[model samples]
Target: MKIAVASGKGGAGKTSIAASLVLAKRGVLAMDLDVEEPNLGILLGCSPGELRPVHQPVAYVEPDLCSGCGRCAQACAYGAIAWFGSGLPVVNESLCHGCGVCPLVCPTGAMREREKVIGEIRSGFVDGAPFLEGRLEVGGVSTVRLIEATIQAGESLHADDWIMDAPPGASCPVSAVLREADAAILVVEPTPFGLSDVAGVLEVVADMKKPAGIVANKTGMGDLSLDDLCRRFSVEVFARYPFTRSAAKAGARGVCPYRSEETWVWKTESLWRAIERRFS
Candidate 1:
């Protein structure tokens, strides 16, 4: 079963919940799909091994072969190609989606399609569970491509269970990770910001028609109640983690706080059981 843990906003303990879930359910492949800022390895206490470059098809223009025609620029719907007065069309690597339209529309055969290394996939093991993560190269714009590569890396492993720690926010990267998930675990806090962002994330999940539950983190921070929110949304409250100093310290030390009996380990364990019951 594939379970995705995501949040609409950052710093809501989404990664914490995901790491705990993987620890509770051994043999589950944990995937960190936040290519922009991957923190799962820090919590998992494992360094990424065997880094492999991930490439995506992008358009490359040969300046010498160009006729200065604006056909390539006109054909690019994404505005990836721009003609500079009389010079050949310049390709904006960041704006290009690699749709192959520019090369197809180039009249002088100046445009060619080639692969560029935008990011890389790093795989390793953490506590007997396979962990894979994607690291997008600096200034690289192909997050969705890197996300697909990360998912593909884990899919190749074929583990007993798969838990994906998706990137925050309801964008392409988040959608890519949640697209194939059997279920979703939305982690949020009790504050207004958390509640609002969680609602947005729930909307995305509802659109995807994926079974979902909520894990409310930092339970003591706000007066807001999740019961009413869950009832209104018809989503279950899967788990709750309170604000604790030890938990924070453990997290800072790159350790799973769920391993400590003083923390909300039991609650997270029950959450994992509920997920297994639902997915199994």
Candidate 2:
């Protein structure tokens, strides 16, 4: 089963949940699609060398090829191609989606498709579970392309279970990662802000018609009103993690709190079993 773990905002323990699931379930391939700020490798104690670079094709304008017509620029829907008054069109490497249409529209063959190393895809073994992740270069805006690369890397493995950990927020990056997931686990805190953001995520999932569930993290410290919100939205509250200082410290040390047989860990284990039962 392909499961995606996501959150409405950052610092909601999404990666922690995803990593614990990978460790608990055997033969699982963990993919970290949070390319912007991937911390899954750090939390799992996986080394950087195990990961490799993943590249994507972007347009390269060959100035010598000819007439500075704006057909290439007009054909590009992503605004990746910009035409300077009379010069050959300049390709904005960052904005290009490498859709290959620009080259087709170039009358003079001035635009060519070339592979660019925009990001890296890394994979390592964590407690016998295969962990794969992608990282986009800083200041890079082609997160969607890198995410596609990450998905391709994980799909090539053909593991029994594919656990995808998406970046925070319900935007293009999150949508790209969650597109093909069999199930989605939306992790949220019990606070008001968490409830509001999760509602947005649920709307997106609902529109996609993807099955989903909620995991309330840091449950004991807040009002726990998220339960009402879930019920109102007809979403299941699959699990809860109580607020604990030791758990916090372990996370700060880049460790999975689920490593111990404690309250939150046991709860997370049960949550995984529930997810498997619902989607397996």
Candidate 3:
């Protein structure tokens, strides 16, 4: 089973809770699918061992090929191929979805696929448990593709269970990760903004028909509550973490407070049990 720990927005202690969940359970593979801002390694204090580049096929037009039928340009669903009615059609690498349609549509076989480095996947261990992470190259437009690659790489571990720290929000990247997960743990702050943000995520979870529970973080820092939102979504609040100076300090230092605080460890364990009961 893969449990995805995600949020509607960033900085709601999602990564912190994910790291704690890994620590609370044994034999669970830890995977960080947040390619854009991957910091689960920092929080877990695990440095990656091998960095392997992830490549994707991008359409390349060969100028030497005779026919400029413009069919490749017109056949592109993503508008990645631009034909100026001149020498050669321009293939926008960023806009290309790597669908390989251009080559199929090309009458002259001018279009071909070339591998492009979109991101890198790294493997490591956190306390003897396998950990995997993906980091997208700067200016790379393949967020969902990289996430898919990361998930594929994680299968090498072949662990009994997995916990993924997904990117915040209900974007394609998050959806890709959630599609591979058995359930989701939505971490949210008890604030108006948090409630509003998580509402979108709940809708996505509901649409995907995935079981999800809310982990309210920074409780007492906000006046608003998640009661109405949870009731509307029919998602239970599995756990709540209080706002404390020490937790804040430990997080700032790239340490999960659950490692030091007894209360935090108990709370995390309780959360894990609740999840197990609901999904087991």
Residue pairs in clash, model 1: none
Candidate 1 TM-score to native = 0.93
Residue 28 displacement in candidate 1 (angstroms): 0.8
lDDT agreement of model 2 with the native:
0.84
Identify the runs in model 2 with alpha carbons over 4 angstroms from their true place. Answer: none
Tens-digit per-residue lDDT, 66-127, candidate 2:
58878888889999888876777888998887789988888878789888878888878877
Number of backbone collisions per candidate? 0, 1, 0
lDDT of 3 by residue, 160-253 (tens): 7999999999889899999999999999998888989988888999999999999999988875777898889988989998888899899999
Model 1 off-target regions past 4 Å?
none
Model 3 lowest lDDT segment of ten? 222-231
- Would you list the C-alpha lDDT of every candidate in the order shown? 0.86, 0.84, 0.90
My TM-score estimates for the predictions, one after another, are 0.93, 0.90, 0.93
